[model samples]
Target chain A: MWVIKRSGEREEYDENKVKQALLRSGASEAEADEILEKLRGRVYNGITTHEIYQHVRRMLDRKRKIRYSLKDAIFSLGPEGHFFESLVARLFQETGYAVRVRECIRGRCIPHEIDILAERGSERYLVECKFHNSAGTRCGIQTALYTYARFLDISEVMPFASPWLVTNTKFSGDVITYARCIGMRLLGWRFPEDGGLESLLESHKLYPITILAIKKDVRNSLLTNGIITIKEIFTKKDRIYDILPELKANEVLYAARAVAECL
Target chain B: MWVIKRSGEREEYDENKVKQALLRSGASEAEADEILEKLRGRVYNGITTHEIYQHVRRMLDRKRKIRYSLKDAIFSLGPEGHFFESLVARLFQETGYAVRVRECIRGRCIPHEIDILAERGSERYLVECKFHNSAGTRCGIQTALYTYARFLDISEVMPFASPWLVTNTKFSGDVITYARCIGMRLLGWRFPEDGGLESLLESHKLYPITILAIKKDVRNSLLTNGIITIKEIFTKKDRIYDILPELKANEVLYAARAVAECL
Candidate 1:
């Protein structure tokens, strides 16, 4: 049986591979064998790895309290997260820096639209945000060097500002090394020794609205209106029922409060 | 007095600036003063810096034995040097490497049209040729990084070949450093410490047709026919009169011989 990979390449399905994945995801050898047996009993020809992944996730979510649903919700923000850049801007704002999104500044040679420019006291940061919806994609060294070059050009005009590279996913090893060598600050999902985008978001009590158990259309509507965080949703809690009339006022407030607590 | 700069900015024309430039170009103080006096008498309003540079070059050319005219001929290749990539491929051919111009190879991720692929004695080189007619413009670090990334993609499939970036102009310092760090060989005009494009052409006895002292139309026709080097002209010397009935047989041969001597 051939299974389609994420990149659309079809390979012969191996039962051992599925069992190995199950075992890696905290299943015992016996449980892995049981899952493999269950999967083999069903039809498997011409199936996609995505379908298998979803089935595995559903199975694991039932047995574990790992909140895979919340993670999947975040993953669902993929194509609909129009306010992701604004969400990043809000995170910077919560961290005490006055943030501007999509600010155009004249460099020495050319004009550059910086994704986020944050200023706190004497420190100024010109940020280049790389928002990749897929976890497989990464911000590579080319992006890092390109942003650094832009920073160099802008620094000739605005010398006080430092360049910061912010990405929704992780940066490649080459990017990290080059950034370190050139003294560029990088913020990615799991980069840096101690802190990264996730830790920063958690510490600043900022949670994206995608994590909420609200309706997709309601979340998208709020995101379109520049409301991205749980804190933003909490502040406009009274109008939540008006925006999403299908949900009860108490339920909306309760979900907002629950998400805000996690933040 | 006002003068237009290359960036289209107008600045007050300083007499000392002209004099300083003249002095730097091996002119005596008296000669500099004489040139400044003559320039002052001419109508200088709304004159571009390019016009001023042309005037200075003309004056310098009159007094010097060095062939600045030949260099200007190379500059005249502007926009019409579509066959420059083919010319570079020819250079590799002269250097005993079997070359393929504009060979499209399927990389691991995307298809890349390598400008020149030179293979000789079990060694293959994937060369990216950047042809710029202007001397002032340079290939920067971004191009280097981009080429390196493409090489990385190609290497996943064709791992034996090396990546080489060849340009008709100089490379920026950052490009040099980055290329050195990444082990991508860069060849440009006056770039590497020892050998550059000019030195390479000289060593290999390959001179571009652009540097030949011939009529513009004839040069363009030859270039259009994929004849880029003096060596190619020499090979086709017997039919030169047939191609251009306007020119005498001796003139074409003379021009070809002169350029070949320079090589």
Candidate 2:
């Protein structure tokens, strides 16, 4: 069997390798085979080895035991700045809000950067990651502007209520007050005594922004597109997308990309 | 009348200037009369005009309407750095923690460069300020170590928590995770977006080394006794101060000086 990976690569799968990975992820051998079979046609030539591994991992990620452990371990090490990103995603998921990590906002003319965009029902939130030694008030302002820009790019179809600035460290009083004045939510993480990853994992509210849900239209688009590639979706542009509604063009692209990728 | 300014200088006060300032701060003439009279004895030679104003501001800080407006308008923009410090103090105060700004800590044989030791309940937090555009992770680490040393010297309280590294900029992921693993809380003010004041406020946590705190106590005792001047405080010999907790010889001298100063 074979499968495609996130890097647009394909790889041949060894049954033993698949079984071992599944076991590590707490998945049964039979279950692994079932996943491999389902993903067979999706595999293609010139797939990197890591892609093959990722394919199995993504497949097993659907299993409750696999998903929980995989996330638990991933969030524990605080790896590649992905630790907080994953935490944010899981938090959005747990809150019953549809969340997309690394949703690119773009327009016909330009590209923009935004980390996690979430939506629930009519409420939408634009979130940016600030993984620093400490997140000062300055971070809040940057996030506020970024979110506001994102809001401008998207129409009322954008589901979040306000822009959010979430950081690993606490925000200064002035920054918090400024954000409040500008209608942005500034969230900070308080330190624990141990200063270990365990302490961080124990706190979910520290993940920064948590929205209620995404727009039904956006959500449907993502589910239907089955977006797995980064380039096919998420453009990097800031052109206005709407005239009557006066939306930034980049936001529409992000909405499209997010809908295409995660159902 | 005379008062000390933030510059550590004293200057004479002008009555007309005082009257004009009181109006700016929104004090009624009757209240201003009472303040001028109350400040009579406390005023001395060579008081600065700014000091007189600060004194009045401190007094008015007790009032409600005036206090809020003062915080929003005057203090918030004054000296920018002081504003942030005051903000930090207020945040801690709201959290039921008593915060001390610009308190120095040093061991007997060491130089005194530490600043802002905040005590909340049984825990002591050491904060060092850095106001700059670019700062590295090492700066954060150095502050945390010094804070740890200061804690051990002063209160004999040993903290199990990792020291904190608070800054205004983000750090490399490896550095942050490594610092966290070794028991350091890397905190950075999310800068520009928040405000650039985090670099002005050093915030971190560290283990307490009682020996270091005691060393500082003895040095302070000597300096307070007139046996040594402020300049001599940093120039003293190495290995000074009685480190033997059970046999505190320097403490006897400290107590003796206390009595003499009282006399």
Candidate 3:
């Protein structure tokens, strides 16, 4: 069957592609194949990608399969950097790095509040989390330049540590060009292609609790107490009232269970 | 007499200080003294600086004496950088430099939208204007770093031109430190003490029309049509409706006439 994309382009619908996406969202191979089989007659020629997405999404949702809106999930953690910092620290930790969030370290000239100090193998890393409140706000050359400058300042005192610029959103062209020139490690939404934040999240299964469909203030209250995983909500279902008011907490728990396996 | 500052500190009121400020605002020395004389006895020892400011501002308004709200006047020009760019270009022009605004210049690695290109005796300059919409939005180390990076790129192609960072707001501490270390010239609200943007504006009479007491949309409309100077409003008083609707233009012209000599 052919599908029309959001961009209005038409292409042949690929079942294998859809199955891989479902597997990424925590479906077993058999379940992904079954979902694709169920989708076979439902998809017609010229059906929109949006319709296909909705159709598959509803089926997976009924099976308690995770639905991914990973971009907005990350944004929900900010206007402030603290929760986002914790999320980044968690990513490093899950990948076998010992991570510390928000440590004030003395640079050569002054004291700098390092966002995340991640150590693994022979390398220690200074990670800067550049969080934005809204979409379409790309990290520009200045962000890259200043991160480099901070690295220059701190490396004088701690020569072993490497600098990494991490952002939840995209980056402008110059940022990537400049970072490559300086050999700086960058982990933005999809800058490095194979090793971007999205792929990293999928592979490491470091899905943030912010991924659950929820509001900012509620997300803040949960993050304030160090709750950062959807599975944590499912684990604490009985004590829903402990996190928030009983009714709201129960609703959050229900929401969490819906997307708990979403990677 | 003594006056209470906004900070709750008490200080002796000096007439010459206010007079100097008034003169900076285009008041004649005699006019400043007369205003000060009128201010006597109305000022109680416990009178707050805010009250004294209101008194002087009201008196100046009545006499058509220039009143300075220099900081806010600059802010009224932006969330966008173009008007602020024009103002900066005007400053350099008034200081005897030949100026061009918003030209695309080729850097070593890429094309750059150069905000202002200024040339005077024996040298040229690449001037970057960093304008913010609101007060307390400061230029951080990243701005300075990215600006320096741009300079490094452009200076290779045009070695005679120096780089300058100008802003309507203040600079963070690291920005100043980094700029000083690199010998980059900075023009901000109050940095160099003798030669900050405020003192420069005072000396050069580069008062912006945005200083007029009007709404942002009205200010934007005027700025959009390249009407930047306060005197320009007085010049176009008869044709006020030409720039905007009759009523708003009339009000604007009235505001302009009140502060026309305000430097």
Chain A TM per prediction? 0.73, 0.40, 0.71
Candidate 1, residue A77: the lDDT equals 56
Q: Could you tally the backbone clashes for each prediction?
A: 0, 66, 0
Q: For residues B5-47, what per-residue lDDT tens digits would candidate 2 score against the true structure? A: 4446555666666665565455788877877787675667876
lDDT by residue (B1-263, candidate 1, tens digit) is 78987657788988887776676445789877877777776638788877876676666633221233333444565674447677678878888999888888876555667788899999998898777766667887667756776676677879646789988788887777667655778888755758877667656756677766677788777777777777877788755656766454477678777655543
Docking class of 2: incorrect
Our tally of clashes for model 3 stands at 0
TM-score, A chain, model 1: 0.73
Candidate 3 residue-wise lDDT, B1-263, digit = tens: 78886667788987776777677666787878888999995888888876876677777753333335676577667767898898888888888999999898776665678899899987998898899875547887667767877777677788745679999888989778777766678999876777889788767766788766788888777888877767567666655578789889878877876665333
lDDT of 1 at A49: 79
Model 2, residue A16: distance off in Å is: 54
lDDT tens digits by residue: candidate 1, A221-249: 77777777778777877566566664555
Write candidate 2's Cα lDDT for A1-263 as tens digits.
45454334455655565566566455676776787787566555655555555566566543333332333233222324544664555555656788888766652212335577778988888776665532122343334433444444342444457766665555555455545554766554432234322233333322111111234354234323332122223431221222112242345455444433332
Q: What value does the lDDT take at residue B69 in candidate 1?
A: 37
TM-score of 2: 0.24
> Between the candidate structures 1 and 2, which one is better when assessed by TM-score?
1
- Give the TM-score of chain B in candidate 2: 0.33
In model 1, the Cα lDDT at residue A73 comes to: 43
Off by over 4 Å in 3: A1-59, A62-67, A106-110, A160-162, A212-222, A230-263, B1-56, B61-67, B106-110, B160-162, B212-222, B230-263
Error of model 1, residue A26, in angstroms: 11
Q: How far is candidate 1 from the true structure (C-alpha RMSD, Å)?
A: 14.4
